[model samples]
Target: MPSSGSYAMVLDSTFSTERRACRFSRILIDGGSSINILYRDTMEKLGIKQGQLQPSRTVFHGIVPGLSCSPIGKVKIDVMFGDKNHFHREPIWFEVVDLDSPYHALLGRPALAKFMEVPHYAYLKMKMPGPKGIITIAGDYQKSLTCAAASSQLDESLFIAEEKRLLDRVVAMASKQSDMPTDPKSAETQGSFQAAKETKKIALDQADPKRFAVVGSHLDNR
Candidate 1:
């Protein structure tokens, strides 16, 4: 087993869009991902116009099985790293997705390859070749933990919202059924009404478990 200090660290960095500079507290430099991704909200906040986005067919899959996300579009933005003297700038293509993550963006394998950088997670740093020399980016352990917690909370909220939406739909359907006229004296009408109630209950029970499973799987992957 590794020592406590030897744990892997989450790396973060500051980047700017065309409009303004932004500091992303939660950036996951993932070597596993083939392409870099930017959250839709972040792109919008950076004043990127919807017309600038080009349609894309790229799909993103999480660690969870059967869970996949599709990007809304793709855009090219200039990304800069390092301090005043040693900073490097490059135009990077990013897939914009509607992801409710704590991270504003994810720098993936492509970005890593572009920078020709090697990440040393144990040391909480990454180094890349620069014009002058090697440039180093450090990770913050405390900030990573805080961001992880916040991301978890956000996931929970989204799950709850989805559940509430399903429940509301079910309730609406029941209310519509109740509004329909039914002759209480007719035995056939009574039987049909009772059957409808049972059907509604069964539908609610079955649909809820599936939806909950999907949400749980997505959360587990994150």
Candidate 2:
């Protein structure tokens, strides 16, 4: 099971008519999907115009044996992923399959694989070689800005190039899955990795006292 805070985020979008930030939670980190998938409601809520979308292919959930059917459509989303230190940005077209979630969409194999190649040190909680600022979105340490920084350095071209390479690698790696280890150590490794991220966030806040809370009103609700 994934930890409580696993979700896919959108940095921006291209809705010829309407455009807005895209976000969703519980996005399946499936390495099985061929392309990214976005929900219709999400698109509407994000103010993405339909005319801006180009045709694209996608896989839907419920391919499993005994489950209700799922509906997916062809849609497009602009995503930026990496870490606050380093990140990448890309505008990819996708289908809107399996559109029933309060969150909005899913980042399938094609999208999930993009981050799998990063050289993260579970012990240190950082990506190797540091961030590439060219593709990263610039702003204060706001949650959204930080999230964008965390995902990519903000270079759209570089982000897409790196993503394509990772996708190809994962496709090959998928066929060689049996060659990989599914050892129990994987859990321990992931726990350590998450801990490092939390630690880094704390350090960032300490470095910049001006930025404190990311979700202001949401915290009050608690």
After best superposition, candidate 1 residue 81: deviation in angstroms?
1.7
Model 2 TM-score relative to the real fold: 0.38
The all-Cα superposition gives candidate 1 an RMSD in Å to the true structure of 18.0
Candidate 2 residue 126 C-alpha distance from true site, Å: 10
State the lDDT of candidate 2 residue by residue for 78-134, as single tens digits: 665544455554555657543334334555556545544221112212121225533
- Assess the local accuracy of residue 143 in candidate 2 as a C-alpha lDDT between 0 and 100: 35
The best candidate by lDDT is 1
Cα lDDT computed for each candidate against the true fold: 0.73, 0.45
Model 2, position 165, has a per-residue lDDT of 90
Q: Candidate 1: where is the Cα deviation over 4 Å?
A: 1-12, 17-20, 63-67, 167-222
* TM-score winner: 1
